[model samples]
Target chain A: MSAPSSSSLSIRDLHASIGDKPILKGLTLDIPKGEVHAIMGKNGAGKSTLAKIMAGHPDYTVTSGDVLLDGESILGIEPDVRARLGLFLAFQYPMEIPGVTIANFIRAALQARLPEGEELEATDYYAKLYSKMDALSVPRNFTSRSVNEGFSGGEKKRCEILQMAMLEPSYAVLDETDSGLDIDALKIVSAGVNALRGPNIGMLVITHYQRLLDYIVPDKVHVMSEGRIIHSGDKDLALKLEAEGYDWVEKEYSAGKSAV
Target chain B: MTTETKPDIDIDRSVGDFRYEMDYAFDAGIGLNEATIDYISDVKGDPDWVREFRKEGYRKFLEKPMPTHWATKDLENIVFENIRYYLSQGQVPKRTWDEVPDDIKKTFERLGIPEQERKFLAGVEAQFDSEAAYSNIKAAVGEQGVIFVGSTEGLKEHPEIFKKWFGKVIPSGDNKFSALNSAVFSGGSFIYVPPGVKVKHPLQAYFRINAQNFGQFERTLIIADEGAELTYMEGCTAPKFETATLHSAVVELVAMKGAKIQYITVQNWSSNVFNLVTKRGIAHEDAEVKWIDCNIGSRLTMKYPGVVMKGKGARGEVVSIALAGDGQHQDTGAKMIHAADNTTSNIISKSISLGSGRSTYRGMVHVPKHLKGCKNNTECDALLINSHSRTDTYPAISVRGQGNAVQHEASVSQISAEQIFYMQQRGLSEAAAMSLAVNGFVNDLVQQFPMEYSVELKRLIDLEMEGSVG
Candidate 1:
């Protein structure tokens, strides 16, 4: 089958595997522009694998699948090319690049988008960076420090958010951004993410815990089991999953799979 | 050594890719022998003592075998018989660019030396082939009794001052390359700041070998008198017009009591050039000497700059960065010899090897048994960009003196796949990501360079990585 002709990040009947192990099987999801979505699942539910596969990571091979960015297939391009095509992945484990400052790192990303022979205005760049950093409550001096090196867990998440704000990607995937953040950190991080939400961007916030959903308040919540979406609901679905756990969803999912 | 107030990247990139055809006034026929020495001495109008000095250096060069046991076996490829020992238009240097021979002046213009001398450099001694084509100094620096001139003119004009320190810090027989430089050296800078006179701005020397098959042996001697301060930057950070198959240079620096000297070298020669150099400095009582060197883009380079602390309370430092691309090897490091009590020394060296390139860090530090209160710290770091890129570290430190403290640190790292992937996810292409990682590895030392050199080097690496990818 061909890809979806829709203005969204469309994953259609995705089947992906890492080496000999299949992780994502027949998964389908679509995130249109100007909305926030959340996916909740237990361990080994393939949530993280789906995020990586969408970003074109080399570790996973798509046995049969299609990932589209705004109605165009982005299946085989390089990760960098995919990023420039407006797909962003906030890593579950952000890399520590020694001796590379935050300012220069973001600048390179922005500079790569500019036309050849064009220069990035340093004064305006720094001013915009300072304002975004202030909104995230990240100290100004953090720009000079190496990216994610020696940074606390909270700082790493904030750094990821800062990069997202700077790049202003069209579709952003936040992978467990609240995994290590405390309550105060979560508040600040959610505020930062909320400030960036508008009619111009689509966001997929993936998390294992429902507490993160309370802060960011996704418009739609989906229950993921055995690699594919089992059920979809409003914000109340997150509360139900948080209170009664995924046992009910898992039971219903298996019954449906076995009967089929 | 040259700094453009606003560097032109196109001109900078092509600085060393173009050559000029010249009509030679003198060319010492190919090969090294007694007749060659006599011819060179006669051409320079050398005195009897100086003539004898060249002969002694020739004898040493003939006796010394290639240092292949500890160096690259490629050293055997330099055909001494095929090399023209000396080639020049004349010995007298032109004070104004217009007076310089048109061909030679065109060489310097292509090198973009005069433009770099406009704002950042206090003086310039532009070397073209075997002689200085153009030289000039700021009036304020000249008024302060700073003598900056080519080695040919320095020997003739200021013999009393030049003779006292010539070959004292690094003698002719120090190494095979040093001996070769001493025997056939021409077209290098020589500077001497008067006692207690501080040259406020750095003096730069621009070197270019425009003649093919001509072995360039530059002999540089810089002496800072008692209580004087000076910074001499050499080997201007640009590729040469035409690669000399062999480039052997000997640089000797002297820092007298309470004096300070900083020698900076940014060498980016063509890939066909084989660079072998011996550089050393002597620091007297309470004096300081620092060497900041950056080596990039050569077929094979084997150099180890050293310092000898000769008087009490002296200090020495060597901060260097080296980058090796495909089919290149950068074998470089530093040496510190403490011959006096209460001396301090520091060495920080970083290197990056890409593609199939190889880099090695070889260092030596020594403190005698009698000296007390001596301290030394050495750090070496290597970064690899590809799976086949290689690096090696060999450090020999001996400290037997009472109350002496010594320390050494080393690390080897490759740009992890995850790191590259992370950068790529941020929209940087694979080549640009690798180039930036390499740039970060050497950014600290690149900062030691003057003016916009760091900026220029970033662009150079970006271009290198793109070519490597292709």
Candidate 2:
């Protein structure tokens, strides 16, 4: 089934935790295809945890509620299987795998998406990899180098986006993709993401500041505080948060929830 | 040297009842005794002094007991009497390829030795059972005052040089296997590079075990004279067998002042073989020695190639990689002894364990208090492919001198599910992901080999990853 145009990702009353300590307490959100949704949160606001739980990370236990992709439950599927089903998570700190070249790493992921016993065409694989790398501004020689080993912060982030663009998942989540980028890298990565934006893929950008939103221009903004989203608005809300800061969101959410 | 009239003998038959066929012929009822030793000595027409040395080594072998304390206890199960220690197979080692017997030539052809030598090797020596069937060195390399030939021929031709350094580094009583090798060693490579000479290409030796229940003891000695440099590679394989075969060998290397020597070995024996070997080198003042060892297949292998830096400004290095698959235990490591001032050593060891396999790194790094400006770095990494696989590291580092600097780092990690998932999401299967992880783990060590060997090593790792997934 194709992804749902509206609300391709629907997280309802989600509760997650590591051991007895709850991280994402009753979090709820909706991200639709053909739209870019940004989640802005302060430190310890569970933004990273939310991204991990949606990717089916094994470390966090989803205590309650459901996470659906295109109206189908993906909470029980394996992480890789969930990824093959059109969901992607771009990690903030990518793992360094030595000896595994970038060419082999991306090829294996693309091969997993093919039919059983069908070998990937080497010529076509390199063609696509080279094209993606060119788009991300990654050097041609990087395909032969090991993945993320000894790479600078900007290079790792670009590598993550290169994989995302190659996989072409229905819904994508970028957690702190701009945390370590310079202004030039931020522009290049934003341009790459914008080039991939279309009706078939939905995007979720999670960041600690609104500076990244200035480059990617998110359509909607959600402010997360104390493990839950307490405010949702248009893109102007990010500019407002940037101007006023999280102290305003925290005070507003605590007072209103206590009064209710 | 008529090539057309030779009869077609099935070289596979020489391999006996082993599943993995060896390429050499076998003698009828060859055993280890004074008579057999005398028969060998007389067959080679050795001088009286050579024969007496063999007798003395034989007495030493009988007096020495097996090494039981350091490695696996299962080594005690090897029955020395059950092994046929002396087997020349009636074929004399020939310096020219045309002089080799037809059956032995066919065996080398089957093992792809000739082709390998033609492509990248500067010299090639094919040893079958207990003798070198064929040995050849490129003419240009030979013209440079470099001598590479079988040890037996070396003794016959250059007795003055061969006898002077023989048993000097690895004496007969150093260990039980070494004594056995000294007493009955038949065919191995003897290489010498004159002072100020540098060999561009690597020389290679391929040892094939052709008979069941037979022991192959090949003694190798490489001496790089002052200001000289050389690289040597050796590969060993035996036919699969129901009953186990024994392989006990001794290798000694001497690097004189301002000289360098690099020795590489890729051993893929059948699972029914006991591979117990003793290899060591000595580096004099301003000399360098390196050992690049790779162990792929064997039931149990206990080999620790060591180096003794005996002179000031000397250096030693060892890069070893081991893969232990089902029913295999790879016990391999390196030892570095700093005996003089300004000596340095670096060791990087990597291992992969699959199924019920086990890989252990038992190493030693020593710098005596008297040694000044000595530095040592040792890093060991092991990757477990499955739940039942196991890995262990036992590093003994002794820095007795205040002026010495030593750094030792070890890490044992399993193939993480998350890492595999990350790779699979990129379009790789579970098996491919695991293979990538393993290759990454050992990339640094594998890259130290020559280009062709490194490519072959990657393919071997891929083959090993098959059937390793749950």
Candidate 3:
């Protein structure tokens, strides 16, 4: 349990829905330790839905699926339980929690991870938080400010990465982490994420464009359409997809479905 | 995504755990009339003129009609004939802690008043059902010519200072409850600070209601002389009762030229108590007055602390936080009256409605045409924890002067699902997440309170949030 094993995050036939309409139809993917996987899909391709379902979001019903963390299914547990079991999802649009300082928020998260009756040391917590914030270029005074309130796009992303650094989740799901960032912010955020890469962690980076793949250079590239992965290749395939476009993948998937 | 969805859960309605046997030395029989008023005045050994004042107040109380506009349905249930006007354990307020009676001393100890007084407070006054049990001021503070005593002693000992400003700020016939409190007011704080004296520590008073179906009316008057500064804090708590209990207090503060006065109240009445209080301050030239109020655990509370800037360059502020649990209504706000030039006022109010509770923010800010350079800013925000919980904001702002600037901003928002989900994703339980968000909502204003009070306020809110809404 101390180290992220091979295939730390494995998704087998994940079918989820929002209300009556199905979103993810038999979606499947996996990421092992010491590896980064990128999933590129167009709008309505259920990319964000997959990330949310894995985090046990209440709005999205997992009709039929098996999402495993180290070979144990986490389909029926609550969202907080999933988080405590070493799962983290970086939302595309982080929520604005008014009046809750960043320092208190992170402290509560870390405190929840501890065993019962074990108090979190305030001095050590602040020291670790300050060092991590320094690495992410966050200001020293941000610890007093409310969580994600009046924050810029880059600051929010960096704050997300800062949380990841603090929580030390076994698997990280970065859902469209590069949605609203400028190039400079993207680079800073990517470097922060790169610094967290190690054999103890697995990452699933879901995005709409191949541009984010250029900086964080995933070990595997996935192309998804209509709620399921239709193609998988090495990192060079991302460059190839950028050279071409998503139109070829949709056409090829339709043709393959007709043949089936 | 716009409206936050609250989980449906019934609130816990258990009353407070602190209770004592009904052991009253004397009890004025149930009802309000001339006989009752006369009996109270006779028992307290009131002078002739003050007895006449009580008769006048009773007439006004009879003439005034119930305030039907502000939560009339809850007001209808209060049966005046069934409520006992006064009750006392007959223990006179003593200067020494050891002289106070056993049960009353034990109650204060349970509330941690003596411990707090030793740690931080400059003076303390403990009031039982109808009279002060113990009132003492530190020797160092008393040596600085600080007059702190019960209103009875204030009127009896220092007639020159007490008679001049006693009923001037809040007249006996101001409101129905105020008139009632004036007619039968028993025990409250009376303080007079000499000129140029600044009391570093806060003076506190604790009021506890022990008997059932009793109404506690305390009159508090604080006067800060020219260039003087003072801070006063009062806390109220009551034991649970089957019948309704009424707590109506009248507090008047007068800040003279260049003086400053800060008044803070933390009220946690039982769920069966009706808390209707009238608190107002008058600020003279270049003076400042601030009111920090927090209300929790009451059935119906209708209180609006107000300030009147009557002289040039005066400033006033009101920071309030109200928590309405199940079967409760917290209708609280502030009123600012700018009567002179260069007067300023600021109000920040935050309220939370949990379970079937309802909260309302009713504020009024007025600047006359003759005034110039008057400024006011008001921010009222409400958070609803359950779908059944409700909130309303009525801001009546009138700006007639050309140079006056008045800003009023209000928002009614529930705890969003996204925010809770985000917090839960960080490994916080649903209850913990809700409480954190709520404490954060009032954190800014809570910080303005004294350190001891701020911590206690947070803890009180945390306890109130437990089993409030799922």
Candidate 4:
């Protein structure tokens, strides 16, 4: 187990399954620091599976894999350990945690990253939370509502971004964040994600459509087919896929596979 | 009050490391017999009618079979011959803490009764074993014509009011335990608020059991006159003992026209105790009665605090939370009887069963055919924390009137693995996650508690949930 050349998020030859069915077969990807990359694929292309496995979801069994965060293996660690080690996943559909307020949910996440016995400063926490909520256009009273309970799709997405901002993770994987958003919501969410792009963090934005890439433009775009990345190119590759559709990529990638 | 001191008390004879056999001025000995009833009546110096009442109650206790159908069969283990009907500190209640007996005062101190009274309560009563050792009401509240004292004093001094309401709401023959309590009922709080006089703070009573195989039967009666408002809270805890203890109490409340009464109880008995308590209230025209109860730690607890709407436009509510830990059974719920027109009642019960524990919700709501515009709602939710934990719901709701409406909802849920993993991903350990989930399951009902008590309840629940799951 050697480190990847770049000190960023990297998944090496990952093979994962849910029960007896394999989802990700030898999936390999890398996103170096200071850059955002996108994985555009059709449904069942192992897009959400990649994000869940990266976050150490309990349902999935990773038979052979090495997930490295800053050049250290995170293969056998628990989900919380991986989370505290700075891995964040913005769920395609956020969980509705009844009776847990939004403020407490985010507070617990941040509190978990703190040293044991260290109390969270209420004033500082509220201050940071209010600022982030304002940036994301979430109402102040949203703090009292149960997490995602009775929330509209847009509000739920914005809440996911609000958490990512508050946690300030080293790497984040936004899984289909644009699925349930309209044009206005998409732009607002894109802007929030764009505001979080910086030099020290790496991000992998997974989406089925290239429309999301129009706003949160990635430095590089990869086309995934059948649980593995088939081709990698610059940002224009997303536009090419969006215009020509996935049929051309599937045909061309299968041809190349057969030729090999 | 008669002041008699017994010289035969031997405080050094320890029955076991955790159990004690304190020599009582009068210990009606173990058993329910004519002699025991006569002994108790003689000790209390009851009037002729009261003595006759006790004799009748003793007969009823023998006649009324154990509610083997509704109550758990464990009731058979409560040997009537093995339980001392009454064991007191053998001292009348004093008005001040300084005047209280040292041994009893130490117990109250350990339970934080004095500090809580000094901080937030309008009055405080401490009952040790079978008698009230200390009772006091704040001067300000007393000046406003509030009455807070032990039941004995209330009956002896204010018989005009006590005689009318006592045993009226819940008759002795209503249930087996109520009859048992009626026979040996000793020390409990008796509170009265005059018309149009509202107490600013809650009146609290703390009950502690010290002797093993000793039965603590406290009879409480609370009355709120017309246009009055008051809240009463009770807390109970007993030391751990190998021998089983019996705690059967009967509490009755009466709210006059347009009055309001809120009763709260947090019972944390030792696992060796069987707590079978009967509590009910009567709400008159436009009156309101609420019961907020939390049951945590008893080997078996069967309590269903009820409310009967006896007058039109009255309202009744019961918000209860029960937690059953290892080797515990909590069969508790609420009963609402809509006997009048245009009455409303609500019941919400939340229970948690952990580590092979069992929790059952047995509720009943009834509106007769003659009543009109009566509405009742009941919701019972149970959370099972372990694979082996058990929960059951038996809700009986009947609405016979054409204009009446009744709704009952019950649900049993287990902690979700996905939710636990989600919380774990947010940095909480599995145990911490489980604790948080359990707290959330009961958070809505707990929020109905007073802020201080709710905080304390959360802490207690957290301690119970530790190591509940691996």
How good is model 2 by TM-score? 0.80
lDDT of 3 by residue, B1-470 (tens): 11122334434433344776757777889998898999888888887877887888888888877887655367778899999998987777999889998888888888898999999999999998899999999999999999999987888888799889987888988888898988888899999999999999999999988888899999899999999999999998887777999999999999999999999999889888999999999999999999999998678899999999999999999999999887788989998999899999999999999877888898989899989999999999999987788888988899996989988899988899888999999999888898899999999999999999999888888777777645
Model 4, span B343-456: residue lDDT tens: 999999999988767888999999999999999889999998767778889998888959998888888888878788777766677777777788888889889888879987
lDDT of 3 by residue, A1-260 (tens): 13334457988888888999998899778788778999998788889888888998889888896888988888999899999999999989999998999999999999999999999999999999999999988999898989999999888988999999999998999999999999998988899999999998899999988889888989999998889998989998888888888888888888989999
The list of candidate 4 runs beyond 4 A from truth reads A247-260, B1-26
Write model 2 residue lDDT over B1-470, tens digit each, in one string.
11111222211222222333333344524457888778778766778877888888889989987777766777877877778876765677677767887767776777778888889999999998888888889999999989999988888888877888889988888877888888778889999999999999999999888778888888888999999999999988887777778888889999999999999998888777889899999999999999999998777898889999999999999899999887788999999999999999999999988777789998999998777899999999888877777788999999995878999999888877778766755545577778779888888788889887888778777767755664
Can you give the lDDT of residue B133 in candidate 4? 91
Question: What would you estimate as the lDDT of candidate 2?
Answer: 0.84
DockQ each: 0.78, 0.35, 0.84, 0.50
Candidate 3 lDDT at B48 equals 83
Top DockQ: which candidate number? 3
> Rank by DockQ, descending?
3, 1, 4, 2
The local distance difference test score of model 1 is 0.86
**Model 2: DockQ score:** 0.35
Comparing 2 with 3 on lDDT, the higher-scoring candidate is 3
TM-score: which is higher, 1 or 2? Answer: 1
RMSD of each: 4.3, 7.7, 3.2, 6.3
lDDT of model 1, residue B154: 90
Native contacts, share recovered per candidate = 0.73, 0.51, 0.90, 0.53
